[model samples]
Target: MIHFNQVSVVYADARTPALDGVDLTVPEGELCLLVGPSGAGKSTLLGAVSGLVPHFTGGTLHGTVTVDGRDTRTHRPRELADLVGTVGQDPLAHFVTDTVEDELAYGMESLGIAPDTMRRRVEETLDLLGLADLRHRPLSTLSGGQQQRVAIGSVLTPHPKVLVLDEPTSALDPAAAEEVLSVLQRLVHDLGTTVLLAEHRLERVVQYADTVVLLPGRGRPPVIGSPAEVMAVSPVHPPVVGLGRAAGWSPLPLSVRDARRRASELRARLVGEPPASRAAEAAEPVAEPVATVTSLGVLRGTVPALDGVTLGLSRGEVVALMGRNGAGKSTLLRTLVGLHKPTSGRVTVGGVVPHRTPATELTRRVGLVPQDPRDLLYATTVRGECANADVDAGAAPGTCRDLVLRLLPGIDDDVHPRDLSEGQRLVLALAVVLTARPPLLLLDEPTRGLDYAAKARLVTVVRELAEQGHTTVLATHDVELAAELADRVVILADGEVVADGPTADVVTSSPAFAPQVAKVLHPQPWLTVHQVERALGAAS
Candidate 1:
């Protein structure tokens, strides 16, 4: 259904081509997953399908890209609207209406579909995506995951033959991600729709893809094959695949269940061995709490978003806030950063109430990296953004730029902020926040768009900060990341804290939040692939 022949895209000012000499094809009624490292041109390849590459992005296309036998170079996105539906990473950017129902129907209305058919498709999409109960709610009030589902449903309502999605499940929780993937499976099997998607969280969607498209970095050619064939050599992969490779398993397993079936000897080897503990556990305790939430209760439009939640963070502590969608994780972060005022209780940072502090004073006490990094970025170039951050934080001129270089090496400073990849943009936002050197740092979803290599750099940065007597709290759904970086885990459900303890105690006990390594090596107390490898090495 989609074909690219000798495709290469070069932007106006870029010296290197985003995509270089790529030839690929996606058959009808199949789901193709595009996998690659950050800045490897996965999004550029996806844009080529709907004619957004050269038409809207103002780039030059060397080769032809066709969808349903129609050349994209000759046709604009509006001209091929009937054949393709595209949903980007940011859902709020795609919405034209206030409520969920209206947003879903806006696309059909633009296409001038028959009223009867549009109404039927709207209801069908709402049901299929599990948005029936939220049909009347405003889009801005929903959680990040719910907004993602609504964005996808809005496109699916048009009933196009080809669907293109970028990081579709990055914002969703585990169960909600499964629901979205299952819907894609049904579309491919029952309805014969062609689905092309790019995702960073490969563990969630790798098992469900019909075929995998691997884009190696450094301007290499693309590799297309089955999931197993591609994952065997793919640099970016989930923990299960890494475990399979470490143990020399043939035909690397894609899912935790398959790995568990082949893990008998591996489990026995790690029977009585305990994993290495984090440095946070052995460090000296703080004299007093850096931030404290006492009976904190926040209300969002008559709904209790945070209910009587009491927590404390000490100096040099790293805590991970985890929960399902709309379980008050983001709400709690916003409360700490003074974005949301508590309705019934109080929150104090350094013994001063966050909600009552002035904006300038609050910047010195706390900093928050929100889920959408674009909200904090407005400068045209990367260098300008870093300079603005330094001025805003009252830091040295080159402080922010130095942090940016450390977080993302080799990124062009003269490039426009809008032209950077999602991961690079996130790192830039983080560098802006770090300029203030706030005592308390909070990240809503830190690793949403980061690849493994970038994530390792962030891990090192956060760990160094913790050692330097900074308090950190990050809310995330990436279990492997939590397993690696978090000293403690705090879980919330329905606006209340359900569990809070050491990382090993909380994540290993819960199935939903456990990483793949823990799932495969059950009852062994292993949390990460690195830990398992260490245990094996020690035993040998």
Candidate 2:
């Protein structure tokens, strides 16, 4: 029961409309997925539903957006609070209270609901999102995934008729993501809530979508249809869709199980050909360790975030740190950059303890791109940010700008850093970190908002850095990226290293960690669609 009639949104000084002449309708009780490349007006469309587009964002709206018989043009976000709930990409920006339980009840309290009713809804939401155990925990102390759940719960407690989420599962681990999606499914089935969401990790949510909306960038009209119909022509898609296209499968499958059911003959055709080995190319003689952790232990509010974890990174090595939510992946990266002091054991970067080194000295030797790219960005314009980055890293003026162009071509130099899309912001942050030419680079969730084209650019830049004798360690939940770029995979669980080995060994052996290509071509050892395409091309 959401309708956009001839909707067009243009920011104050933007040359083109973020959304142009868009007409879309989401029927009641249906979950519609908005899919597109970065900067495709997906976030703008979501904002329109909750009355945040022109109202809070200071933009001009050309047409009316109505939700449940209420025109967003007439009702502000606060007026539509009972009928709409919106969660933006950054969850930390949404929280008003410090603790999980208080955040969940805050919305209902604002709505002036009875205290008893608010309490009942709070308990129900806590159980629905699996946040019962973390009810008392401070929001700042929780993991990214945990904070995401709390953000969602705070909105869900209002029992709104519509839920609009931007990348709801982006920060969640596989299992946690599944739980969140399952909750949405229940809401659509039992509660008759209208759910509209945008997610880059299409593999996790495409199969569950009732309708798919494709917004080709550059002010193109939106395409609306079933998942298969849209994915057949969509430029950005998951590995399963790519595999389906490569093999000429009719009606592309959306999930791994569907692809596996149709993969028998294709697997047979590639029987004798093995995928090319990325690990072999990366197996050069190991140089001196760039960073070393010996029995590292870190405590977060009495919880052991990292427990006796020992790891090493050699010069020119590219390692990926992977694990479930709250499994110590982010903690390890922070430890290397000296953000978290180890409660026990020691960490040394460039042969000196990271915690003991001065901030300026440590930044020269090691640069970190945090999970939230906004942490590294504060300047108003893109050019200003790059200039500041050059000054901070002691590099030439144009060094950071050149890297930004390489990572994301055609980005406007005069645009505000906050106005850029999530992916573009990430690319800018990466460029800022790379300006110093640090011996070691750390990226946490680097590809969270990137499209396929942008991700390919990142892959090339990361590989080039390794070739120049730089050590790179990235913490990620994107399995497909790790499969394509990582020389080695290190998995942590329960604050300890559970598995550490070559990329092939670590990813293919675990079902949860395997990419879509590996899942479809199991026992064949192929990890990426590109690898399989290359092998088949060579054999033919």
Candidate 3:
């Protein structure tokens, strides 16, 4: 469906091509998973297919790149609109209509499709993507995952033959992501539509991919082939892939089922040295009160957003704040950070009232990374952004340079923070806040746009910070991320804490928010795949 032959793309100001003499062909109806570290140019490659690179983005192009045998350079995005449909990271940013059903029909109306036909397509899409129940809901009322699905449905209603998605599930919960991926699968297997996606959550899609395209770092060659073939040798492997590598298994397994099947046979075939004994079942860390809210309550307009809710974060702990959208999670975080002063009850951070302290003083001890990376970044260069953030940290000039380099080694110092990819900018903004070494850290959807490696980096960074006695709080819809990284899992429902306990105790109790692994391994207290791998046979 798409072919690139010695295709190199260079922005007018760029010193080098974003894609370097790349050569590859994607067969019709193939679901190709594009995987790589940040700034590996996944967006650049996808833009090439949709005529956004050299055409919309104003870049110099060389060699041949074609979509459905039509030259990309000649066919701009509008020209290729009917040929391909794209869904990006921020679905709300792209939405033009107010309601779900209308949003789905927007694309069809643009293509001059008849009203009757458009209605039928919208109905089919509603059922296919499981949005029939939500057909009348306002787009603003939907959750992050539901909004992203609406974005996909909006594009699919036009019945485009080629679908291009860039990090479609980065902002959704695991269940939401599964819905989007299932839609993509049906589009390919049932409808014979070709699918090309750039995503960070490999666990959701890698096992089913017909082709995998791994872009080499900025200056290297692109590796493209079957899932097992490319992943077997890739230096940057997913955790499960890493497990296969450590286990010395041939024909690397991408999913746990495959791993289990192979491990059972390998147990008999080999008497290799047992891997180092895994960590013992860790005792639950004592929860200390870092920031406590006693009898806290707040009202939005007339409705109470939070009511008599008592919440606390402990020193040296990762607490995952789980809830439905508009369930008061954001309100609680904002209130804690002094953005929204609580109407009642005492809120304390490090035993000091955040509301009573000066804003500058509060920021010094507390770091809050917001949901939209755009909100935090307002500087011309990545370095400049970090420098501005540093003025509060009382650090010498250029202090953020080393700090950013430490946390985000993949980011170049010169690029504008806004110009980087969604995931890149997110991680960069996060690195800026960490420069302060705040005693208490607050993050909202920290892993939204980050890739697998980036997610792993954030997990490690948070773990290290907690071990150093800094309190960490994360507001996320990603249950899997919560299960893996959180020491204490707190579920928020309608603005009050509905459930609270150790990660194993809370997440393992609810199927709605539990990690997929919990379904297979019952009676397992471990919340992470890494923990499971390290403690293999310890339970047996």
Give the alpha carbon lDDT tens digit for every residue of 344-389 in model 3.
8889887788878888788877888877778888889887887887
| CA lDDT, candidate 1, residue 111 | 93
- Write the residue-wise lDDT of candidate 1 on 138-229 in tens digits: 99999988899999999999889999999998888787888889999999999999999999899898998889999885679999999999
Better of 2 and 3 by TM-score: 2
Best by lDDT: 2
Reference-based TM-score of each model = 0.97, 0.97, 0.87
lDDT of 2: 0.91
Best by TM-score: 2
Q: What is the lDDT of residue 183 in candidate 2?
A: 95
Report model 1's TM-score to 2 decimal places: 0.97
Residue pairs clashing, model 3: none
Q: Considering summed lDDT, which 10 consecutive residues are worst modelled in model 3? A: 273-282
Evaluation by lDDT, superior candidate among 2 and 3: 2
Candidate 1 vs candidate 3: the TM-score winner is 1
Which residue ranges in model 1 land beyond 4 Å of their true spot? 279-287
Worst ten-residue run, lDDT, model 2? 278-287
